[model samples]
Target: MSGLFVPMTKANGLGNMPDLLEQWAGSRSVARAYGRAGLPMEVIQFPETWIPVDAIRSLFEISARAAGDRCFGLHVGKDMTHKTFGLWMKYSVQAATLRDGLIRANQSSRFQQTGGKVVFVPGAQVSFWRYVAPPMQTSSQVQHCDHLIWPTIRFIQSYLGPLWLPEWVDVSYPRDADARLLEAQVPFPVRFGTPYLSMAIRNRDLSPRTPRPFGDGQRITFDAVRASEAAGPSNETLGTVFNTITLRLLEGQTDIDGAACQLGIGVQKLQRDLRREGVDYRDLLNRAKRVRAQELLSDTDMTVIDIALSLGYSDHGNFSRAFRKMTGVAPSGFRARKDQMQ
Candidate 1:
């Protein structure tokens, strides 16, 4: 929960970077860089997959050595789009405002990443976003830090239109380790050795914008929900177990008894353990359903009935009551507002 957890798709920039390096540096250099980083030549070959955060950081290191003092991360982060995070990215960008978009991204982030979560703090004139992570123990973490901050800026840029820029960028690392190339790309000041790695933007920039109208891509993004299953906490903590059950529910498996059996425990024992952990099984289930329902209402054209069925509800009436109890809005009403705002 304190350290970074990244999605496999985060390394996808490496696939595109080799070609970019071949263009900016040379094909020979790309091979040599990968080799120096002790990676396979096929490291340049990109696939649509999700991997652990540490692994992606390793790939970023290889790309960095290959690029050699060039602004590697800045370029890679700049080219990022919704496709980078698949469905989660798609749903986030379609939010009503930059703030709302970021919150949506944070909610759906576990669908793409589970090691850390986005923390947003609002102020009277400015707002800050921190990709909170645990203490670093690996050498490759710095690379992941760079990747996290830059892509976030890029995502905000895409949401607020290209003219957007942050007030400043802050990093948890020492100032001397700063990359000059990255500094050159940032329009605002970059400060290092801060308490948290974060970005600050003016509050006005967070104003809500019009949501996008309906489109076929919405349905395609909805179908891509399965891709997010790869993201989960890599530990055995209760939160991790909660996330696992949530994923199972999303996959149309909702039986807590079966989940307990899968965990090699009886249902009653599982309940006892959850109580010891200060969580109720039903509460976890409700939270999971709430998150899933919000995503469907905001990002898909799926009707309330279809969404309820997908969440394993007996009927829309039951779904509506539960959704309202949790979110204070009916499914159809939620969808309507999302549509009108868009």
Candidate 2:
């Protein structure tokens, strides 16, 4: 199991998911889904515990199939409330403004899940709230992606009112007949075959608003849970190192020293650790760059040179050489191939 774990609170949605699954698919199917994921149904009772992300993905995929609904993930996300994520939701709801809440959520997301990140990019006109999935490949990310996006939209609506809509939604998957089901539910345009999953929020809607009060009982419980969890062993692992590297790359920082510093470790120690894990730091760095480069090439209209610079390459030639060496295709050629496939 990779060290990547999503808190069980976020996974089972505070016991709401199993009940919903049972309603959508039936008790037998819910059991089968859990069994296939190698997780017992009772695991949802442990909200403070964490489970491997792979298991969560498997559960979503299995449940979607069992429910016989292509939009099952969206439905599941739609049904979730703030209670689904416990403290994570509390942090957001208690903020002074929607923007502040989103920023806090972005910062606190590491406590909710590992291996991926939610980035809140603020802008004067249109800000973007993006979900960057783990760099590792998965069998099917459709349900997982759908599951993530809807909750974020719901969070946004918590402040903007239930009827508020984003400027647009970008999904990485291709448009299919089933996509219409998603499109039908939202007034905003839902674009498919994009590089990432994101929602565009207008700045005007992000004004300061009254903060929601956190009651005494809830605050005491939240603090107790936080203290207890803080006493537990650190969950940091190589998977987290990869996640950190990916985030640093997105910020246009490429040096191993920077990544090591961010991880609170010396460069030599980091190298030694990777060596023990049967991995090389340079290889991992290259892998992250390759994955990000491919995403920019295939999804956005950014020029190859711009992508290269953004990924920290000094010039177009070096980036092309590195990209070709890893992928056997130049950046432009790769983008062309992707376009043809679409």
Best by TM-score: 2
In candidate 1, which residue pairs get closer than 3 Å at backbone N, Cα or C atoms, i.e. clash? 2-133, 2-134, 3-134, 8-50, 8-51, 211-342
Task: Give the Cα error of residue 340 in candidate 1, in Å.
Answer: 36
How well does each candidate superpose onto the true structure, as a TM-score?
0.57, 0.62
Please write out the lDDT profile of model 1 over residues 32-135, one tens digit for every residue: 76555434453233232233344456656666766674456556656665456556777777666888877877777655554556778888898998777644
Per-residue CA lDDT of candidate 2, range 32-151, in tens?
988897555645644444555666777888888998888877777777765567676676666668888778778766666666677888887999988776553347767767776667
Displacement of residue 39 (Cα, Å) in model 2 is 1.9
Q: RMSD (Cα, Å) of candidate 2?
A: 19.9
Worst 10 residues of 2 by lDDT: 1-10
Off by over 4 Å in 1: 1-10, 13-15, 24-46, 140-142, 148-150, 177-181, 214-342
Best by lDDT, which number? 2
Query: What's the TM for model 1?
Result: 0.57
**Candidate 1 at residue 198, lDDT?**
86
